[model samples]
Target: MGFRKGISILTISAAFALALSGCTSDKPAPSASTAPTASSSPSDSGEGGTDAKLEALGLDSNLKFKETRKITVEVYDRGNDGGTKPEDNFYTTYIKEGMLRDHNVEVTFVPVPRWTETEVINNYLAANQAPDVSLTYSYPTIQTYANMGGILDLAPILAENKELFPDMFEYLTETNIYWDQDPATGTLWALEGRLNVLNRINTFVRQDWLQKLNIEPPTNLQEFESMLRAFKDNASTLLGADADKMIPFSTSFDVGWRADHLTTSFMPNDLTDKDIYVNGFDDRLFLMPNYKEGIRTLNKWYNEGLVWKDFPLYPAGDTTEDNLMKLGHVGAFMHNWDYPYRNGDDSIHASLQRLVGPDAAYVAVESFPNDAGVYKKFLSGPIDRKVFFPATNKEPIASLLYVNWISKFENRVFLQFGEEGVTHEKLPDGSLKTIATTGEKIMNSPANIDYTITSNGINLGDPDLTVKSIANGYAGVDSKLIEIAHKITTNDGRIGKNANVGQIKAEDGQGQALKEKRDTILNKAVVAAVDKFDEIYDSGMKDYLNSGGQAIIDERKAAWEKTYGTETMLK
Candidate 1:
């Protein structure tokens, strides 16, 4: 079946999507009102001093407003085609309408396709037709615009409405804001955004196949190898007549997704750990000894015929692995827990369950102990992008008001869901649920906005949600897999350091180059282990450590010293 059809099976049923009656928490008792008054004057309290009269528009705040104005805004559309609507465009209509209706500020939304978000936005800005606010994903882009004086510094606005934006303000302060300031100079450019801590890679296997072979889930590396061997052997027997029928184990390496996840197995520590700085530098791109070990593991798997030879060239989103697993051909793969749950497809989940019965499971695996025994989890920041305002904006206060209006909870929800009763409903259990208003349920309906817009809050590091979302629909998932995943914590000592100084200078080009180098070295090492482990180690392993590896350690050491002082570095 086509990938789209395969995914449709997992899509939320229209009935389920529309039936949004979840429990609700009792509303909090009203507290003494200390809300700030809306003022047009630049003197409004905030980061920088303001004396100019402020013209506010969009959603009116609870605080009384003096005057209101209407403005048109162009915003990127994140909703899929099936659910596209004027109000569904959160950045354009939803936010604009909420601000205008609530705060007596009128705003108009212009939708831009995701494929042309950057291009269309830049073009508009260049043509002096910029919107009040523009959204972007990359931090570097935001920094570039901010440095060019193309965007307003929100610091003052944030300060002025501190109570109105405690969570947002806290997020900005706790995370690094991109701006340049020099004690020696005068002002620095800084960027602000949310940080995501947990890296999403995890192990996915055919749990149903495990039960068919009566093999237990793998724990350490040895057990994992044993399971792979069984998978290969069983596939050989089942497809004894067909050479192409055997699916030992496989994953796509196209676009670096599969390769990156595979490399994580050899990580001696959590990639997020800051302890193992390069020599004395803090750069993480530098090579480390553990990288060699990871490569060796991959080499071993390849030589043993555990990994598919054609993996490196597979097209992304192709059904090769999915079909194999569904047909009970492949044994295991590595992917994020949410892969099976999203994109309006649940066939992967359904196929696994039907084939395996109840043996399918999802698990997370981590590397061994480090000096500190503390595993560093990757964190995501709040600011996905810096909102850029054009220098040509006749009234920047309108933009500020627009932003402030949407920052409110009610406005945010409106931007996410159309009319609550129409698009969704609160469940008896208080949990929010999605509902399909149209004939077809949108894959990422506004009801799912929390996942797409807001950063994971309490959901971070949660294994249960992980399993339920990814593996539960499949039959093979079990407790043993969860146990294995939970045991894998952050490793601190084995983290890699950035040592590619020459490459770093090239910016984006350098980042891609270093990644290619690392992958090449690692891939070779992994395949070599089946022949002579020693040869693999000697060739790529030693050179990587001695050259790039040592530099990384040195860099990390220096960084540690700077952060903790000379006395701590000595210890």
Candidate 2:
């Protein structure tokens, strides 16, 4: 509990204590890593200095290095109680043994409890003892910190040192700034880490169930409905005696995106489309016409017993689905983040093997298009994690230099895969062979380096190589499963962007509360009776808007108008 955790043996939760709760990706790659070869773009200027020698220490002429520079970082010590100290872990060891010996730098990793990451980070931030840089999954937390001036604005350094992280900088440039706008300056305050770039959420169907019931995979809403109906009809034979208990479809309570897939077709991004949008602060969706229709469609499914009866009460973060999916009762899920097929051994492929047998298969189907003839999908691109710097960090230049240094090829590899022979072996094909079977120990091992180190992707320059490496990582599972995701990303992808334009300062504090309020009311309305939906939704909408929703909209509208022209904001 004390902030002075200098090699403190703190009992913590799982290794994912530092994992961000906001946006998630396929539970970290299966030991896939970035290579040291500068096959991609390597920068020479900014981030310490533009010269290659300066690239080593990432130290600018202004930063005079002493005999030893003790740079503290918030390291994720999975708290496995394996007696591995934060600084002694393989990832940390790489820094001390390999990279830091010449520079005489002491990198201290302050163990960040994985379970209560937000609170822990906030406590550290408040006390001015937060690590030099911390990687968190929560963007809202980053936004708040930047807004409150608890963190330094990266825009200045980023502009000056654009050459230091050329690949990452180019990535941010192409991706529209990763949506990390500081409320005060309307600029980015934190470094963005990209969990996923391509590939939208796949609509996973119970292929075995479909085969058992002899129903084809749905192409559109009508076919989707028929498939759901078929599952409902043949539940006993297909899903076993628990047929009566089977849920055709369901979503989570906190972040119910199952219906959002349907809403995507109706939700337009720009002024050219018929659907009106207010693109600010998580895109205030209260007045969207398509959103209501999306809910209405779900309500129909609920009345027909296609959707789960308890969806409204189903808790968030895989609480309900994890249990329900194992029972082999849920027929389909739309908002599956990392479609189980793509993951390594513990993916959906293996899960079905446990529940029904190895023969069980989930149909990897194309996303269904709405009545408007468009398949809507939420955007997770630009960035996923917020890598931030605290104002209290003493080694500002050293910290930024470290960032650029790690972005370099060799250091990047060490941070990700660790020493080749020790933690992983170099394959004849130039790929990595991880000795550790568990996802945690495979790549970063003993430390949450991949999660805590930087915001870069697994493959630095080549995306195709990245895909192939990802599939290979899951060599334990069917390579085809992971490949399907990449395949879908290239083919008839129904990715819709919900305008990740700018941010409204108002949306940070009370705005989140209002958004959750809207989600709660929307969930209730979706499951409500046909006649009662309008009543429930209307009353709730009135209350939500009056309480804080209108103010959020007003502020967001003003911001959007000020950002994009009035025509774009209005139309």
Best by lDDT: 2
RMSD of each: 13.4, 10.2
Report the C-alpha lDDT of model 2 over 423-501, residue by residue, as the tens digit: 4566665666443344234432321334335544465356655555555554345667556655554353433343444
lDDT of 1 at 180: 20
Error of 1 at 103 (Å): 5.1
| Cα TM-score of candidate 2 | 0.73
Best by TM-score: 2
Tens digit per residue, CA lDDT, model 1, 298-375: 666788788877666543335566666665566666654334323323345545556645445333544222333443
TM-score of each: 0.60, 0.73
How far in Å is the alpha carbon of 409 misplaced in model 1?
Answer: 3.3
Candidate 2's C-alpha runs over 4 A off are: 1-64, 71-89, 92-99, 102-105, 108-129, 136-143, 155-188, 268-277, 283-287, 312-320, 411-436, 443-453, 489-503, 563-571
